[model samples]
Target: MDSNWGSSSNLDSEWEEHRRQMMEEDEEDDARMRTNTQLTATAATLWTQEQIQQEGPWGGSVVGRSNKRRGRALGHQKLMMDYFVPNPIYTLENFRRRYRMRRHVFLHLVNDIPNVNPYFRQTTDATGNLGFSPHQKLTSALRMLAYASLADQINESMRMSESTSIENLGEFVVQLFTRTRMSTFDNQHMRT
Candidate 1:
């Protein structure tokens, strides 16, 4: 054996074995590093095939788009109020006919109860149109009780959700109870 490349057969064999072992370890480390990098990159999205089909829900569930949703005009067309959902109750006739309540009584509710202010107040939304008004909520509750109608009927007339009508009825009833201090009916009142 040459003195330069191979000093002795035993020493050369040991050096070659060490080199081979180091190369194997380096390959294993590289594989591990590549796997870790891939895992870290995948952690950000973590999207599965099923999740991809679900239309990318971050925190919210996939809700169906409403056909009756109000929006800005298409090609500068005027966006008018729809046939349903009354906005302002300016006249007594209009107020009474829709909500089955007199204009003065409606006004009295708005003025008397502090909580009713929040329930019936006209709010300005992003589009600057008067969003859900207090009048509408009151009307929803009244109509639901008067006709024993479902929340869907209130939803159509008020342009809100069935859940909202149910919510309004619950809140209206609670507030009415609190404001009037009325609890259980008198035994005499319900006597046959």
Candidate 2:
């Protein structure tokens, strides 16, 4: 019974020592957390201030850059008004026959058409030149787009509607040559 009491007293003292150690660990953890929190807050505030400084008052410099960019764009648009062809129809057969290239090579060229045409005719006069009205521009843009849509059918790239395809291709260059000869004959007859 005395030995049992002695062991209980020893356990009580050890438990008190363990409790003190736990309290010290808790204090250290809290101090570390508060320091981390303060550092995080300071970093965030500095970042916000730097952002404000770079942005300036009401983001005036950014607004100025955007306005200048817009003006340059408008100026480029104005330059497109001279020597612009409207909805220019490119005859693939004429290109193929003229260049004496294979049909497959011609198709590749045709695929490159839409991208090239816009750049070539981007700027023109309002009178159906490059600087088109909203509707004309839209139509021209559509024509440019149609090249890609029709590229599949063109030069046997893919199957497509036959009637529509023929019309889109326009008359063969041979026919144009024949018509030119006939017109020249008529002009010569009128001169006689």
Candidate 3:
């Protein structure tokens, strides 16, 4: 009886000790988490302060600081001379081969797309800098589609950013599909 009691008491003490160690470990983990959270908050505060300092009250200068205008007008001129002009540098066969479509069809799309979606329309910025023309946006989108090329591949030739190229592609696809669907519906209704 005495031996059994001694063993039970020993077991209880061992269990208590184990529980105490586990609680201590949990407390240490909680402390670490709290410290990490505080550090993250401090870092975020510092970043906010830096940004506030850099960007003045008006904020135009800092906002425009990173925007690099990539001479889109020159790119548009080069594109026109290369393909869209009456006596273009590239022949009809070259245009067809590169664009995977007839020149007329490409031009028709360029002409019609701006009517369907205003995003294709060229506009001037607040600083009176001309934005990318419809021709440039469509050409970039078509090149990406025809070549299965990455958006960045069009950057140098098209004078647009990778993100802009991707955006143009997405918008082009959506607008084209919309136009096609509406035309198809009209045709079906007319036949009916």
Candidate 4:
């Protein structure tokens, strides 16, 4: 009975030692994980800072103070060749089908919208690069309205961002509605 009692106590001590070792290992693992997480976070922050310094304020290279160039000139050239130029690639019927309006009306809107809203007018960027033409902005807006398409959908063809597309749509709708409202009000006043 004395030997049995001694063996039982030894087993209990062994079990407690094993449990203590396991707990220590678990604490070491947790500490290692915390250190790894902190290192990863530091590396990410450094990378972001380096990227910001390289990209400057415009999300582009700092040397030119220009945003990432998307070949706007090439996009404009393609647009003109496709639909606006004399003897364009697409016929008038094709233009009408795509634009849901005649070429003349589209041109009129392109010409007139800039007068009402300066946003539609093309301007030079900080880097002396000409911005998008009124036609491009109007087309982007009209395409969204006509097709119920997302703004990014036109980026490949229109060479504008999703935000730009949405802005164009809002401006176009506001200006068109304002013009129509003013015209109607003026006619009503004249009749009265």
TM-score of each: 0.43, 0.32, 0.62, 0.64
Q: What residue pairs clash in candidate 4, if any at all?
A: none
- Candidate 3 local lDDT, 1-192, one digit each (tens): 999999999999999999999999998997797566556445434543454455434324454458776899999999999999999999999999999999999999889888878999999978998989999999998887668777789999999877677677767766655555576579779999
Predicted structure 1: clash tally: 1
Candidate 1 has which clashing residue pairs, if any? 120-134
Candidate 4 per-residue lDDT over residues 20-52, each given as its tens digit: 999999989977975665564454345444544
Of candidates 4 and 3, the better by lDDT: 3
Q: How close is candidate 1 to the true structure, as a TM-score?
A: 0.43
Q: After superposition, how far is residue 46 of candidate 3 from its true place, in Å?
A: 38
TM-score of 4: 0.64
User: Which regions in candidate 4 have their CA more than 4 angstroms from the true location?
Assistant: 1-67
Cα RMSD, model 3? 20.6
Question: Which of the predicted structures, 1 or 3, would earn the higher TM-score when compared with the native?
Answer: 3
Candidate 1 residue 83 Cα shift, in angstroms, is 14
As a whole number from 0 to 100, the lDDT of residue 155 in candidate 4 is 87
Residue 77 of candidate 2: its Cα lDDT? 43
Q: TM-score: which candidate is best?
A: 4
Please give, for residues 92-181, the per-residue lDDT of candidate 2 as tens digits: 464345335544563453344435344222354333433322222222222323342342233232122223223222222222234445
lDDT value, candidate 4, whole model: 0.78
The TM-score, computed over Cα atoms with residue i paired to residue i, of candidate 3 is 0.62
Give the candidates in order of lDDT, highest first. 3, 4, 1, 2
Please give the TM-score that candidate 2 achieves against the real structure.
0.32
Cα RMSD (Å) between model 4 and the true structure?
23.0
